[model samples]
Target chain A: MERKLQERKVNNIVCRCEEVTEQEIRDAIRKFNLTTVDEVKRLTRAGMGLCQGRTCGSLMEKILSEEINKKVSELLPLKKRPPVRPIKIKLLAKKERESE
Target chain B: MNKTADVTVVGGGVIGCSIAYYLAKKGADVIVVEKNKGPSFGASGTNQGACPLQLFEPPVLELARQSLKLYKNLSEEIGYDIEYDNVGALVCSVDEKQYSDMKKHVEKKKKQGINVRLIEREELLKLEPTLGENVVVGVEEWESCGVNPFKVNYGFACAARRLGARFLFSTEVGKIEKDKDKVTSVATDKGKIITNFLVNAAGAWSPQIGKMLGLVIPVKPRRGQIIVTEPTPLNKRWRCISDADYLLTTAFDLKATEVSKDKRIKLGVAGVYLQESTGNWTIGSSRDFADYNTNVTMQTIRYIAKRAIKFIPKLKDVSCIRTFAGLRPFCYVDGLPILSKVDNPQNFVIATGHAGEGITLAPITGKLISELIVENKTSLPIDAFSFSRFKNAYLQNLG
Candidate 1:
């Protein structure tokens, strides 16, 4: 378990909500050469946290733009995930099943 | 008696007070007006008060980096103890695939002259022992930290006052009366505040304030919900979760992530809550476009709880005493803070559209506003942030 923490330290926690880390972010950035925050979120889950990257977006965008060498203004916010709030999976499934 | 100050700053939040304190320190007779009874009432007052620079935009990151230096000396400078901690921040991830992706981010951040780096799981445990077993990676920035924002904003206001900046609370600037191209007076709910210069640092209310001056600002409101927890000792050194997507939260380019976002199950960078010296763990946030309204919803609070629960097991037992929401001056059209001299208008500067990162950009924005007003020079480039950049987009979309 201690080893897990150590290994995770170097990895990027893309989604603090899920404890997603840096290595995930790097893979997503390179896998797509991500040009925006939304892509990073979709591919790596960086901004998918409790705060929804509200606190992290600026840093994320800064890190993304600086590393990607793209203009900061070019990045777009990740497509906000639905349920914009947490809903019970049972309720979610009921809604989806009903819609289906 | 000519009581008019050299500068009359509107909306006394962290941004306003930070600007006012600096101006007052520089020997300017400045006056700050507030709709609240005192400082630190809005988002600045309500924030989890994390001063970590890791959760910021690039331009804002640089500004935050600069402000951080001042933050270290803030207690001494302001003669008040601002609860700031530079314990470091981290963004953690799981899975081999996630780890590899973080590698690319590290390489990119390196190129930009930032100190962010990736650590393996073994090192992650060394940094924080309480993380769940599922945790595999953490992008760490030892340079980041947190602050007691209530005190920071309060200190800025009090210090600014002590330094000769005046405060007029419960006063909202309803109109910015301009003559030809220059602002002549700031008309408030109280009356006309005769002044020579105007600084529109009104947070979520900036767009309306800008329009009152007949100047255009692309600022809009986006609401965020936050939650605070009961005291515990699981604190780590101020680490923040990068949440890979948060690194590019504003990337509009289709090729960036390239997936049609309208279909994603979730979007946001998540967790990094360590304990403060007082033994409290402050965690947060959920995003909603509920528009300009600040209300705490059960759904948002539960979302925050589940999000935190997934990462830190200790959170499962902690008590969440409160949940609240604050409005960020969101500018969705273009990813830029609208800053430009009220074109052709002398001594009128428009500074808002900070969106979620207003706190991160507060110090530097204040510096830049001061530079533009006092020396007519900017500490950093202001072209991208020009309030006028949206005019073209606004006009183009008109068709």
Candidate 2:
């Protein structure tokens, strides 16, 4: 996966599960005024596409804290919703439709 | 290190979680204490996610309108898909009386800036052909929308947690420690935590929590049951459908015992139907003041199914997968939601009593509460939902 990421030609892939690159994260930071892992996840879908941030959360936070010139604790973590594992949208939709 | 916080929010439901999220975002040291292990453990987890403007008066309409605007960006902002679909809603009128009443109601709502119009039976059928033949007229609100309630609750909670908000789940607030008409700390089943401010968003249990402070909230539990159908094909164009009389069942004076008995006789069953993205249809619901009993009865479920079938005859063949019940925290004082700070308690804020619209009004509730705590005032005028509105009732109950 690391070799494949280096060979991607355009940039260094940081989050292998989400195929997110360091350049993309930096671009999202500048473009969206992102200062935390949470903001990066929302704008670039860096830690949300796959792995639910298990692989790239710390990396993203380190990059964010460095970019914002803030301590690690100052930057917020990525927000996580239920069903951390991938579930079919059909099931979630079915559950949400009902008014119980 | 002791677990001290700037604000301690009671209840892990949507309202509490949203308030916590906004407060944390505003840089307040927040702690949420919930008896349940996670958020949306109450009525916030249940109910169809309808945010219709026509169903509310001025006070609620203002909040609902603002919340709708916030929901448009909530999914993106929170890094979660709340599935907010602005499909609109239809209020079907089955008789002449209902038709005229609906017409007047639409006019009133229109005056309040709601984008609603009265449609003829032909137009209504054109919009939703599956509607029953008894429907004479319909009032359609084009701006109405639905969302995933659970996602909304969890989204707010997760965002709040990410922003350094501490969540103490499965820790019941056994006692409230106050100092001379001011909130000082909260004693939970796990341990005692000190706090500067307190927020009561305990859904059905808000009144019970208020008893610890000698406050009367006038909120009660209204039990509403719903039924979920299997993956059945529904018209994507069709919006949420509702019988015109759903609001009448939530009257303050109507006791649950009396309404439950009369509903069995006349069965003034109004159907509320919404199709999910999964090709399943959710139909409901029956309301009564069941006093925190969140049990789904076979009788009520059967009645809801029959009534839904009356609205859309196509649902007659769909098999119901399951049934569930949720308790709506209905406040009896002027039928408005309570969102105010008590006079006696210096740092105590009450943000419950939203009833059925809790899901719809949560965003504004959070914004208002955070603004009150952080800025010492609210951007929105919350005079109508003031705690003083129920002061007379609270005094009478005390007597």
Candidate 3:
């Protein structure tokens, strides 16, 4: 019998944007021994979505910070890039061809 | 290392990841934050992967077109196989009423400069012989495409990271500490992180994110239920099929539960999406009033499975193994998303309400958002999707 499956560990929200529960994030964090938020993002999409981290990033940082007893700034905010939304492949191709 | 990014993105969904990818490709110091293990786990992960430019609303259609083009070569550019399938889409009609509706829909689709065509039973059968014998006519858009939603999200995330972008996961925002209308810094569950600008990609959580800045982003959850069957030996060239009215899968009727107890009655062809690699065919989805919860109901599973089997009897041997649901964040009335700046506080840039199209509109949405933050010039015209449009009714009464 899968005892872990049978165990009723109550679920809680650790990341609200994606609706990822605390037990789940904690499990990943503990299992992975994650340190930075970026590692957590790769492991889990906790801060990804529309509200972005406007609502949940700090809370997750706190959860991890409290668990490890570190300042949030030590972890640092995540990075950003270009093409903030979905786009056309043809546009990219056109630009590529133009450059060549 | 006290490094500051050109911009800070809150969500790691396809929308957020795409934006990050673009900025990084342009040599912008980009940061993305995710709450789950990775991007595409929420609405981005669960919705259909239709990149259909033919069916989108006008302005959105333009964005969809650009997104479609990006998707065509994203696999090569992003260095990942997103499982793009331009095998075409079919809308099988069961009755004359639907046939007539489809005829009109096809006519309009052509007038809109789309390449959709109507096919009779013979052509439909030639296209998909395993289709139920009853399927009479179908609307086929040969150029329409489908993608792996999870892969799309992952591709953007991975591509963004490769381009010198950083992402923070398993972290939550505690407060948007603001100075007057300008955001000074963001406090996390751990500590404070300062930034020059904030992009709201919280999906269903957009409303709460706005509340932090004394702004109101009207976003709510529209739930969709899905059922998956055991893998079958389905061909790769096969297309995704649905009813012309398959779009109505979002609305659920709790009263119909009694009728479904006895016989398999398909309300409409609402749920339709497929995985090109997996034989586990996904079928009939319901749009329910249920909020943020990811619970699976037997009633919904039965109705969807039964209708899918009815549409294609080959499913009898392929027993259903799992049923799941996802939430789409939508703006109440305006079909457009909230992708504009807000008043009162300047640190927040809103980007929500992509609805079921988040997977499709992601790339363009991210592009436009980055332009707004970095160069302050949107590559595409998005006047119809501005956040200030709701000022008359919503922003005035924000909680």
Candidate 4:
């Protein structure tokens, strides 16, 4: 049973609101060295969805804290920039001459 | 490839987008270069989005009155749902002194062709039962409207694009390249934009853009913190309600204490609250010179929340979803925006510093700027908003 627990593939869905899986979070953490919930969010879409982290904020924090071996309080969230919500790339792009 | 434009509008806020839309609609090749990824990324996107006809001085009153009519059909004209909700706003007062002042304001606005009425406490209660018992009188502006700020901004950008206007997002203007006295082109992070006309609509950063051209634009960032409350089923149809004290604090008026003649009540929070169509209440705000800081402090948020609860007791039970801040492009000179052609740089036009009134005054401002660009004269009386108003102060400060 302990070996099976170790072999488990971290496929559990963490942020049900954003449909982000624990495997995706771990992969994002490994890929980007994410040490905060907001970092994981930017990388894996963990808490960037409808709930705005209401459902899985703490879970992401817990995973980050455990992965980094640091207090959750010490890990600050990602700095927010403009276009806070996802905007369409096409809408933001320059207009085409053909369309004109 | 070098992009060429007939007019280059800096900043992609509602003002810039509005200007671009009108300019393009008039057959001018326009390009709006925004540092942010999208329009309304500044104060335009973050404001209460109230289109009130009251509480404005003469030209602003006339401009807002016109803009209200423009907003009524802007969504239809632009083929976008700017979500213009035509709900009346109530300017409430809880004290006897406030009531008399509100009466004067209503009378003054009424004479300006605004549909305003002074409602006493009994009728105010009938209109807004959620208002606290301390309400004495209220001024109702039936023509006031609410809108989604993001949609108003992006809608203008999209409509402008549809009309052959080009928008360059995530592109910051680095320098204004000029030849002798005329603005030849605007150099951006991407490339140089060669243009015949240049408009500085950079909002809080308008001064920075002006500095690139050796011009003095006296606009600074006035920090305003607003709190959002989780949606409640109650107060869904509640019109916008606020304490009359907002007029004083909105400007950080030094004479507010002297004018009010009341020293007991602190003036920072005035119970300015508005509900959005999203069911959340976007309660606002505080006006302070934070020098471009948009950080939402716990102190200001707590102050805002406390005052909001005082005005509407039911908000006490509602939890806050989030609190954010936006820097209003406050003009220090006469508290009015600078909208005029630069005397030295003949082709450079400035349309900025609308401050909190940006959302309300965008359309008329756009039309006036376009008129200045195309016809060299606007129908609106803009003698008060000229660049020359700051000339003496500009020289004195330079000295």
Candidate 5:
């Protein structure tokens, strides 16, 4: 049924890295009156996972815009940090090569 | 928004929110104006959340003690769970020279009645089994703790709201109107707020606010980078840990003798490992005068990772989830916060320049600032932290 499908969508995992559900994100937005993606990320840990919100960044912005009745262009994306992708600490800790 | 209030607090970071909450609890009308969308968008939220008591000295140690007591009951008092973890801290030393230095530091702290002791490698390894073999000794402080930085900031903002404090988020303060020697109103992009007292708790931006009043608030932005790792069971039982060099790098501003030839020391990279309640280890910290830039460099990230691996070898296998940077409001004079009431601005208060200890000192700073405003005197001796101490320095800088 369409109604059952809609219910499943609410439980859909938005951020796979953190296992954060769409409903959980909605609840946090409503509770904290969060307007920005960074604020919601800090409160619900949506984008604070191994991938660092790279996959779910756009989806979160879309959801926020729809919930707040604002256009997608009006919403700011989640703040990006370094290490665009997850990197092993051993690789990062490896000493740099010396020049001749 | 209310057109008038007894106090107008600039900046909605943890310091401002805590001051607002304390003032509101005392039934003072308060308004906090923040340019950001919410609180803790700065260093307060980005920190590793460690409150190690072994790093404090003299007057600051007294404030840290009082703040620790407040943090124990803060969650209940604010009606919010701040995720406060009182697991204590370990300041590890990797060499005999550093161990001797730590022993002297411990003796000084013990004389000050601090609950700390120097432990050999045997006991150090017993406390943190995952620590690297290079760890020589550790100074264990039983009273240190960690808290969720975001929650602590948000908790204070919410509690202040509940106590009838108004927060004007996304509002930029354009000008501060003063009548001769007293603050009259604060003009923002949204509107002007008529207020009797104004508290400049803007952290790194306190200097700009001071510039508006023709005063030099000696606060500069010191950039620090931190890395967060994926959830690992290896750090499940570990308490907050740091290298003894971290104190020299942060508190003492790297004035100590050159201990290592590693370039990481130049970047102020020190090993500080803290496992959040979520099982993810937050490793940090670096210090540099990068103005207002908060970008985490690849080289700095690599240095921090190497430093972390030097402390906890198991961390070398863990995957880094993210890396971010924050700008600490470092005070140039004596490396202490400037919490005081200014005579020039009569009703203006300066509560900024906390450097790396903002989160650890928030509660006491708020209580003391509120006491100065409401009761006209503080419960603790704050004359040492007054603006008058920097009067000569300010005059010299002007000349």
Candidate 6:
């Protein structure tokens, strides 16, 4: 069973939100010589979906570290911006009004 | 590292990458030094990618026009898909005062031979039904377009690399050594690179590079927050839409305190809606003087959301997936970029201080700076953007 798993191609989906495959992430890192998650995100749209890299960020980092032959500690995590989760514009607007 | 190059461009943002590409294309030994891990990690990667030609006047307009023309064939020239879409842009007015203001502005633009026309509410709505009922008037600039900012930055870097330009990432430029008045070498954390010419294309960090040479570059970091909405079905063709106030306020350099007591105006909240090729809408933006801070405040995000909703109305239902901020390299001295060869540092050239228009002006900035270096003269007159103009201002501010 372990040998069969090893033989299987890297076809597993890394970022479900963007439907980015593991092979796609690995290829982008190798082709672009990417060292950062942000660069990979811009090139392949792996971490730019609704989840915003929350799910696939570490998976991508692992792939990046392996491709670049660098320590996982050396690779910076994906940048986290505001709106941790998707929120309706109406919610933000309502919050502003309530504050006012 | 090459250790020696004909030219060393600091900052691997769009400006630096573009300059490197142009310089390398001219057969000059070029080296790009970036403090970040990759290209476009700065403001170049964070902008909304709107090329609004109707926003400028005179010499600056000439640069914008030239840039727009170059963008038409840039994807093929660079052999990379920059996603340059010439879909045009709409500058809509939400009030009667703004409507009258736009009418006069449109007339001036028409006289200047810009392909722009003022449209009434009916025509404006027909063009963009997503706009709210408050939209009284709009000006359609047919020449304006939007490109993928990331792709454009990467395209230039990749093309330059293909053309034999050396890019040194994760490298911070330390000291710039000079022989008399001419630049001799640049000291980076990596090593000393001996180069005859140096181009400062550091975007918001231009002032720091200027400081290294004992020069005061009047560039400050002006924070602009932006919100990105989830992909939604568009009823009509995608067009870059912006509020008239955004252009007017930026053009006039209206102080937030002077404009109104309203918090939104104080925060410099302006609506600029752009739907990327991915169908996700990138909404923005709010401007504030936040020295090198790229953090998006909850208040600013809410204010931007409110302003966007005020313009599109349907945006109220759209979910905001993310919000981010970028610091524009705001040049306080005359609000124009100082793209000039400095007299003191003879071999040193300054090609920055493009605040919000970096994306729009990247190609022209690259071409003109390359011309200044290779040909020692430009195809178009750049005397207006010289550093000598800021000598008196810098002295006065220092005193």
> iRMS of every model, one decimal?
14.8, 11.5, 16.9, 17.7, 1.1, 1.1
The residue-by-residue lDDT of candidate 2 on B1-399, one tens digit each, is: 457999999998989999999999999999999887566668987687777667777777889999888888999888878889876888776767776678788879888988888889988777778887878888888677788887788789878888999988778998898889899889988888899999999988999899999887888887777766655666745668877766434333345335465553233345578886756666766666678778776566667766676677777766565556788888865557899899878899999988878988998899999999999999999988888887777678789
CA lDDT of each candidate?
Answer: 0.66, 0.77, 0.68, 0.77, 0.87, 0.86
Model 2: CAPRI class:
incorrect
> All candidates' TM-scores?
0.75, 0.78, 0.74, 0.80, 0.95, 0.95
- lDDT string, candidate 6, A1-100, tens digits: 8867654547688888888888888887876678998888998899889989988889888888998898889988888987888999998877745447
Query: Quality of candidate 1's docking, in CAPRI categories?
Result: incorrect
lDDT of 3 at B326: 79
Per-residue lDDT tens digits for candidate 5, residues B1-399, read: 638999999999999999999999999999999998899888888898889888887778899999999999999999989889986888887877886688888889889898787889987677678988988988877788899888899999989998999999999889999899999999999999999999999999999999999888888998889999998874534468988888755445645423545677877888678987788999998887788999998888888898888789888888998888999998887678899999888999999988889999999999999999999999999887888888887778789
Ranking by DockQ: 5, 6, 2, 4, 3, 1
True-vs-predicted CA distance for residue B298, candidate 3, Å: 1.3
Tens digits of lDDT, candidate 1, B42-69: 7776566665565565655576788777
Worst 10 residues of 5 chain B by lDDT: B250-259
Per-model root-mean-square deviation over C-alphas: 16.4, 9.1, 13.9, 11.5, 2.1, 2.1
Assess each model's interface with DockQ, reporting 2 decimals per model. Answer: 0.02, 0.03, 0.02, 0.03, 0.77, 0.75
lDDT of 2 by residue, A28-74 (tens): 67654455576576445566543667788988998788777888887
Give the per-residue lDDT digits (tens) of candidate 3, residues B1-399. 333556778887878888888878877888787777566667886666766555575777788888888888989998987888785676667565677777887887788777888888787777676677777678777666888777788778878888888888776777877777787677766556677788889888778778877776767887776755545677534557775445322222324422453333332225464634445566656655467877765555555655665557666565444455778787775646888877657657888888768888888887888788777878898888888788776645664
How well does candidate 1 score on lDDT at residue B146?
Answer: 70
Candidate 4 chain A TM is 0.67
Pairs that collide in candidate 4 are none
User: What is candidate 3's lDDT per residue for A9-33, written digit by digit as tens?
Assistant: 3266656746677677776567545
Cα misplacement distance, residue A63 of candidate 3 (Å): 26
lDDT of 1 by residue, A1-100 (tens): 9989878656745456546666666665664345667546534445544456665677678767876887778766543433455333223212223342
